[model samples]
Target: MRQRNLSIPRTSVTALVAAMAAVLYLCLAALPVHAAEGFDFYTDSPGIHVTAGDALSFNLHLAGSNAAGSDVALSVASMPEGFTGFFKSGSYEVTKVHASGDGADTIATFQTTVPSDVADGVYEIVLHAASEGGFEDDLILTLTVSGLESGESNFHVEYPDQEGVSGTAFSYSTTIANNTLNTQNYNFSSNAPAGWTVAFSSESTQVSSLEVESGSSKSVTITVTPPEKVEAGDYTVECAATSAKEQLSTALNVKILGTYGLDLSTTDGRLSFDAFANKESSVTLKLTNSGNIALENISLTSSAPAGWEVSFDSSVIDALEPGASKEVVAHVVPGKDSLTGDYVTIMSASCDNQSAQASFRITVKTQTGWGIFALVIIIAVAAGLYGVMKKYGRR
Candidate 1:
């Protein structure tokens, strides 16, 4: 049972994570602004909860002594997803977009619309008003939607492999499945991992949900391009299926497969060298396959600073059995007139777009010119004192 490298595959894993994020935005409902300035505004019911794509009207009363009938300018500052702020006559009504308002109150009223594909949770709507008598008011109204309607759509995320990946870009595929009877139109969405892009068939594009027939299914493929600097890790995201009839949602979990691409000189994974100008040193690389799946066509590449050079004996490997291990070597050298102190370079191993890098350091030392002059001055002084002592002995 050799220790397997725990690097994730870059391209495949990234794509999957991006898809999950897109779906998450649609399932989790954004809460409306819940802070307001009014007569010590408080909700008698604590909060109102609702599901994605559902609509409701709530009656909130403004109770204050000597504050009634004073022209209060009611304004809604914020609202949750799929909701708009407006006013009817006096009562607060939450409806879909394009729904009519009932004009009833002399003072301004606030209304909103609830989107059909939002998630279940509590949302906030902030209300504010001011009076001529120097009285001001604010309120935090709670809106909660629970559970899913149509309940037939689900989303699942898949990463490339969990062990490790070498490249910067990962490819992910998302399957948006419709489990209900009626044909549904859906919007495919995701939030990609940091430094990554989500592309569908047309380069990480957005897509509408497929119209699935009863007992049938459809899926969309999304490609994720992660930044070249991302490391391996576990990431989760939410995905949703949206249509005019109703919305459905599911969670996606992804694991990029492969070992982190860098290799090591010592078992503790440290690079080693001594100060030497115009000399080269040898370092060993112990490559590990951290991914669940085997890797193929592995190769090494390098980058160095001025006056420093690097090369590798083995640039490519054929196959890495899952959980297997192998080794390679890298050479570092400084030019004849290279400066001293510390010189650094980076070596990357890439398979397709997946890659990883190892940092290299070199030290230089020179014992010429000024160094030789100092040594000669010290020797001459010592010789002169020896000559004077010899003259005294002869006398």
Candidate 2:
């Protein structure tokens, strides 16, 4: 065996070493780099229990990476069939979220709904968050759906159907339940028709919010007042109870019962009349039923000056139908010694639940008998004096 000793130049060796170093640097640069910290995702609730036809919500938090921030888009990658998912921020829905490199965390919310006809079982929901910079993370949430037992719900509202007259206040007894394990503070509100006033009261005191313990319920009274001039019809009111965890609503139907009213006036549409002292005056009054129902046993009454006699032709009426009018005659006799001036006599007509009033003025005049007697006496004295003067002149 022969051995050959081949030696390289210093420049060549130095050049080769530099080239190898460059190649190593390039290979290392081509490899993926791992950072000390990166985008992280977490949620407060990883497992939730709900009933069919119910909704579940949770919050998701995202911590930014130390090196750079990213705009992450969130979505539900997979879920059970007939399940609907929503991502929201305060009151608006959002799909993409932005985080800064300043070490601050961003929060997003997730909501899922289970269909009413779904079977009771455990379902897995996969949530994915992908960044524009190629950073991706996935989280798994477990959902357990069960059939709703009797009188069991996350929240509920109970009310009775009601009927009331227009312009009247209607109250409903409503029961609210809290079926969760934690005590909840719920805010009470209502959506009513225009020109209506609605309020909620607990234990006779008006309240805007109330606290209910876990697995307990409270009864609240909801009062709905229609406008003064509302027409007779059917109306609806929607009442809601809201909290951070849940929102519930119920509708109440109300049928308005028409009101009863009456209008009383003279036949000439006049509310006042004139009369003479010591004489009989006749007046005609008409009663108009302005209500929706018929009125029975209509009666007439009056409050007149002292020593005045007032009589009605028909003191009691048999029946008065709605949108109909009936006339009655009144005979008013002023006192013999009634003074001359204006005097008022109030007449009222009432039937069932309705009543109306009218007034009349009486002007008493001096009797003509005294004036005629004085004139006759003056004429007799004048004639007698003239005869006496003539006889004395002739003597």
Candidate 3:
């Protein structure tokens, strides 16, 4: 009696099934297209160690499932005692990396070095990669270091050399490691060439000294600028990081390709001169090779108004040594019956890959022509007056 037709009608059952199917479809559609929204931090070589003086780097990979990129902050959650480490993106030290959130992997280099005095041991390290979107990932690293190396310096550098023309600035990125058990205040200095200047900066701020805690490292940028008249050569800049009872020194090399500069001006640096209409004028122009390199086949040219004549005594120079000057007399003739006003003349001197220009302002004076007209009028009036005097005297 209790089992009498307990099932629903066929239509009702079909409707219920359709409703359930619709609900399932809606749930799937509401989900994100890329639901794998998380970060994975890993490395190909997580366990590596070197001698205390040397260092090792880990190629870390941080992947995000979101199609849009993300910014991930990286940190060393647990570092072994007496160990120094830093993170780098290319040659620059970095605290974060941009994760390629398109399900692709972003790479970072994690560099670590133990103190030169640490004991031989195997240690465990923890690194964390977290993003602002509350997604995070952790990585475990293992290191097996041998006994510490004695009498080793705690200084490292990315690039300690540069090449450029003379009078250019040479920059280097250096890292100072404090591996001792105490914090250190390290003063900075450089013994560069004469008439050269050295500067140090950390985090974009200039600093003469830097402080580092135990088992930590800091990065600094050193810039050396040569003087205006510096010679072309290879020079070594000895940079020093000194603390109480300790000093770390590194030498940086700068190679100058030799500057080649040309300057065209007057003796007094005055570029303006005056010339009368239809009259000839002259200006002594100086062509100086102010660079360290000699200039060859220097060609001098001028741009003036139409029909104007400009001739240089030395239109072309065979060669001019550095720090030497050559005088050229530029004979400028105004155009025939040129307008009485100020005009511009562009004087140019160009050598192989080097050039200079001087702008001269020439004032065309019509007073010279006016003087001749006045003389002609006076002659005519005097002739007329003489003829009239003769004729009237006879009458």
Top lDDT model: 3
- CA lDDT, every model vs. true structure: 0.58, 0.79, 0.82
Q: TM-score of predicted model 2?
A: 0.55
lDDT of 3 by residue, 138-210 (tens): 8888877665333343777788778887767778898998876446789998888789999999999999999
Each prediction's total of clashing residue pairs, residues at least 3 apart in sequence or on different chains, is 75, 0, 0
My TM-score estimates for the predictions, one after another, are 0.39, 0.55, 0.50
RMSD after Cα superposition, model 2: 12.4
lDDT digits (tens) for residues 305-328 of candidate 2 = 899999999998888888999999
Which residue window of length 10 is worst by lDDT in model 3?
Answer: 144-153
Off by over 4 Å in 1: 1-268, 367-388
Which residue pairs in candidate 2 have backbone atoms (N, alpha carbon, C) closer than 3 angstroms, thus clashing? none
TM-score order, best first, reads 2, 3, 1
lDDT-wise, the better of 1 and 2 is 2
Question: What C-alpha lDDT, on a 0 to 100 scale, does residue 111 get in candidate 1?
Answer: 48
Better of 1 and 3 by TM-score: 3
**Candidate 2 minimal-lDDT segment of 10 residues:** 148-157
